[model samples]
Target: MPVITFANTKGGAGKTTAVLLLATELARMGHRVTVLDADPQLWISRWSEMSGEMRNLSVISHVTMASMETHIRENRSNTDCFIIDLPGTKSPLLTMALGISDHVLIPVQGSAMDARGASEVLEHIELLNRKMGMKIDHSVVLTRVNAMISTRSMLLVKALLAEKNVRVLNTPIAERAAFRDIFDCGGTLEALDCQKVSNVEKAMENVRNFAYEVLRLMPVRVVRSDRDGKFLGRKAA
Candidate 1:
């Protein structure tokens, strides 16, 4: 399984939202997805509880540095992708997760503070690469973007990432009411009521594109077994 981690050293950068979108989308696409909720706030865990049981999707709550690897090792065979939601602060867990992850996604908002938080994460990854020779794959994904207009701060953030030579996904998670309502409604975007939420279709499209970009970076290969008519998943080489 390819472990993809959503991490930022600062909170309110839409880290959890990105995690949920990717996990739900991948699960909806028939890939077994396991989410490790390492955030102490337990947002993902609470969402899972509210969402009840979903097919092809599982959430492990209260994951810590000590239990992180054990959980991944135990669930490796069954999961096609492992999404790790790290806490929004500077912690040792960030380093540990970075080392193990196949790709680290740092969600950054259109503000200086968010940029600084992303910088901390990028620095940590660099440290791992330089000090330990662990060149972890990573990218900065812009989140909570205004769909209608590009603010000056957003442009600056993009420029900064370009200046730093950081790879950023072209697709950005738009600021949508449906993105927030999913937390309260406790279901995937497909399960949400279009009548109750404004621009639900647009929100779903954004997530679809976001998930598509993520899968492009870290793909899961599924092959069929001729004898048993079963499908086996492996991380793409």
Candidate 2:
């Protein structure tokens, strides 16, 4: 089972936006993606209610630390990918989610606060690896990047992340209005009217790249079948 967990200790790191982008894109690709909305804020849940019906996509709200694994076990039959959206603040739920995740994505901005928040999560992941040998794979994704140009400051930060031996995604999420309007409009990037939203096509391309990298980076493992609960190939292209 490939479960991807998105976590950032600091709010405003664009974590929720990235989660929605990946979830919708995966569903669009014909994968049965189930989003477990663990965040009390329920942004994804609200969006799901508004999205009406998305093919191969479902959202389960009010997820708790106690019922998280239960939901996974029960849905193991139908879910192709489980995406968990954690709260911005660190809590016991964070550790619980990380324990069951196949991969962790940390959204970092070119700011001290975002970096600090990401670092905290990384340390926890490292701790789990060192102590329990969990071997949780993780990467840092730069968010809200300037689309027109990559500033030298951003490059400096990227270099710093590299020096720390952190894996950074080649694709940085651009600061686009389409990403913002999706929350209000209650649909996906494809549903947005390109004529109205600036760079909607560009945003779609960015999301495609982001999702491609995500699928490439996720581990290929045999998991329970959606129908029979037997081992099956989920990484098939």
Give the TM-score of each candidate: 0.95, 0.92
Pairs of residues clashing in candidate 1: none
**What is the model-wide C-alpha lDDT for candidate 2?**
0.87
* Global local distance difference test of model 1: 0.91
The most accurate candidate by TM-score is 1
In angstroms, how far off is 93's CA in candidate 2?
0.8
Residue range with the least summed lDDT across 10 consecutive positions in model 2? 222-231
lDDT of 2 by residue, 31-104 (tens): 67899999999999999898888877899999999999999999988888899999999899999898999899
Best by lDDT: 1
Tell me the tens digit of each residue's lDDT in model 1 across 1-237. 789999899889999999999999888777788999999999999999999999779999999999999999999888888999999999999999999999999999999999999999999999999999998999999999999999999999999999999999999999999999999999899899999999988998999899888888875564323344345545454
